[model samples]
Target: MASVALSGKVAVVTGSGGGIGRAVAIAMAEAGASVVINDVGASLHGEGASGSPANETKALIEATGGRAAINTDSVAEWDGAQKIVQCALDNFSRIDIVVNNAGILRDSIFHKMDPNDWRAVIDVHLHGTFNVSRAAAEHFRRQESGAYVHMTSGSGLAGMVGQANYSAAKLGITALSKVIALDMGRYNVRSNCIAPIAWSRMTSSIPEDSPEKKALVEKLKRMTPDKNAPLAVYLASDAARHVNAQIFGVRLHEIYLMGQSRMLRSVHRSEGWTPESIAEHAMPALQGSFMSVQSSSQLIPWDPI
Candidate 1:
């Protein structure tokens, strides 16, 4: 697999200190891609920075006979993001893949959420994705080949309470992925998103104040970080060459091809009547197709199995 599929390729996985990012980095290394482990070593809420996590992942990859380099640049800044992609060239001489797995959560309910919290999450998730992907785009265009695997979330794809900022940023990632795929397809560069359902540091932050929530958390725990790594690896490799601009979800043993924004039902009026008539006629015609407001848990109410 290495010799034929991914040998001589380089991959940069941002926020790779631990959890999903770390898992993806290790998987990339194992699949024969020289990995750049980029992490700011921040907490779940984007507090503080250290180099320990990135170093540990680098060591783990090397100990298992995989080549990896540590990079501690935050993806939120264009300069920092540029350095991350450049790290691959410096260490491996070329880059073939970018895994936009870096993220920090600032989950808050809509009413009480502060502006700072919203901006922080958007900066890291949305802007960071753009910054890193844009930085890599230059090389990808010149070489005429590259693959991008971005970390989206159920919180974004599906509704979740107390996470308006997160949801918005996440859903926005899907749109960005779609556009990149469309714009870069001529260059053989592809972009795709993964809404991973894993019990990692990110999920550890979920409130567990009641038995029901606690039980849900337990089910979540079974969906370990590694469960999502294989899909990321496949997406980054040439194996998914024909797959582009698609949204996927990795949940335990289930891999879902999630839906994008598409019209379910459309109402057309010959005359385009007044507001009241339209509301009365068009709404009734469209009401059956209207989506219900449901959180991620409510929609997937069954057990993980």
Candidate 2:
């Protein structure tokens, strides 16, 4: 049987101080990869920073006899991201994999959402992912092989209430990952996105007494961050070299291969028809394919699994 190992590889994982990021960074190290643990130690809303998160994560890896380093740079800024990438080169000598898992949430109904709320989430998730990826591109190109594991969310893919900013940013990341895969595929660099459902600081907001929350909590007992790390580790390894430009989801006991957007139905006319004719012809043809405007909650109506 073929084994999945990252021996001799160097990886940088953003926002790895805790939660999914921490799990991923540690997993990479356990796979024999040297790791750069990057985390600014920001609160869930992206406010304030401390070095404890990154330092603690690094210590955890070191305790397990794995080579690791801590970085407190924010990925939201171009220079900060550059410094993070450079940290890997300076410490590990080369870069092989990057996991962009840094993010924050600012939920609000779209109409009532504040402009600042929208911008802040976009800056951290969308722009942050771009910044880190850009910083690593040059090094990855020089090395001729690299892999990116970008974190997305159900809020973006399936749509959720009160997550206007978060959803938009996460969805943007999905698109961005695909483009990076396309642009860097020829150079043997691959990129893929994951929408993870886990119990973490990010998910602590669920109402404690709700049935949905209880079920989700029960589901998470089995689908821990530890369990979610394998898929990311696989994506970063040579075994999945050909798996690029894809979207996946990790739920309790299942791994989902998600679908992308495409034309479900279409109608054509020999000659350009008036709006009236098209409305009648196109609407009739596409009626069967029309999807209901239900939010993520309505569609799943269950726990994380």
Candidate 3:
């Protein structure tokens, strides 16, 4: 089979300064795409900024003879996102792919969580995604071709304690990607989401010197951002033009497609039923399919593979 190539293509990868975003940016460039590496160089908690990370990533790409430029704009802001897209047009002329990989973590127990924490995470993960995607949509629609690869998470797909804010935002991105896929399909635009389990500063929250944490780190070492990058690159390639509106998961060597929400089973009644009748009839039918109330970790209790 012939290898997938991105020659003559241009891509924009938000949060490309480090981790999975950096790996994806480099991979896209290696695949022959001119890339816009956008990153404000914010810390994991979305605090502080530095230009070094974006500069280093740009340098790395250039060192390998890959065409790339850096944009230190916040994707959370509408104007900043427009500038990021404009940077791509200014340098590469046209954009063929957009990878929304930038996000911040603000984990806290739901009841005890601060409103500011919730808003901060939502603004970055959800609003930032909208800002960039909306900016690119106009160009993609005019060109009649584009691909969107968004970063989602297991925290949203499954469930994670102390991550209500992050989980909600991640899940919102998944839905947004799906809607974009539906709306842009006719224009040859594809949008898909990936819930990846790879180590980054975000996962550094796992305390050191614990057995579970040690196991997770070992597994993550093998996983790497590189392992996850190929999938993003593939989604952006011409080969995956037919693949859209899907949720995928990458864990170590495992790559799986996730099933979205759907009715598992249904029951019908000859006539309208009261609350008592619903309890008597519907409860029994749905009981067998009911998942446990506990979160993913509480149910499985295993380290990342």
Candidate 4:
């Protein structure tokens, strides 16, 4: 197998200034792709912008004999996203991969969540993912070849306490990836989601108010952002040509094929009765399949392998 799995390809990795986004951007370049390091240089809270971080990433790639260009447009905006895509075309002549890894943390308990926070997070995560993906869809369709690797989260797929806004946006990205896969399959364009568990600034923002929360954060420190990079690179490569619309979870060396919405079991009634009858009949049948309201750490309890 060749280490250059993405040779002759061009990839645009959003939020490639640091953390997981930076890691994935470097990995894409190392795999022989001309990369577009797209970052608005916003902080973890989605405020402020600077070009130094993006320039730093570009310098790192160029230092290793890899090709990369800087793109500072905001993924959350329509015209800005098109410009991001256009940057790739202008720099590398074409694009073959798009990694939607740009996001921000605006966590708040449901009732306490400000509408402003909700809109900001959604604008960057949900609408941002959609805008960039939609902009690239045209080129992908015309070329009849492309791959999309979206960054989803365990917070959304499983559950979290203070991130109503973030959770909704991440889960929405998964659904968006699925729909994009369905809509663009005929064009030979693939879309998929990666729910990665890694220690980054995003995870660092978690409050350690409890012993259990503190312990979980300590364990997460062992899972570096680079662990998720190889998976993104593989999914973007020709080697994963047959994979589509799938959700993958990466924890250290473990790679899981996460399950999608599927019916475990179903029951039917000849004639429906009152609500009291539904409690008697449906409750027992469904209770066995009910999943616990557990956080991602609670579900994956042991230290990552």
Best by lDDT: 4
Provide the overall lDDT of each model, using Cα atoms, as 2-decimal numbers.
0.91, 0.89, 0.89, 0.93
- Local accuracy of candidate 2 as per-residue lDDT tens digits, 86-139: 999999889999999998888888899999999999998999999999999988
All candidates: CA RMSD in angstroms? 1.4, 1.7, 1.8, 1.2
Clashing pairs in 3: none
lDDT of 1 by residue, 1-305 (tens): 53235678999999899999999989889889899999999999999989999999999999999999989888999999999989999999988999998888887779999999999999999999999999999999999999999999888888899998888889998999999999999999999999999999988998899998899889989999999999998988888899999999988999989988888998887887789987899889989998888887787766677
Q: Between prediction 1 and prediction 2, which has the larger lDDT?
A: 1
List candidate 4 segments past 4 Å from native.
2-4
Tens digits of per-residue lDDT for model 3, 239-299: 9988999999888777889889898898888997789988999889889998776754454
> For candidate 1, what is the total of clashing residue pairs?
0
Ranked by TM-score, the better of candidates 1 and 3 is 1
lDDT, residue 137, model 2: 96
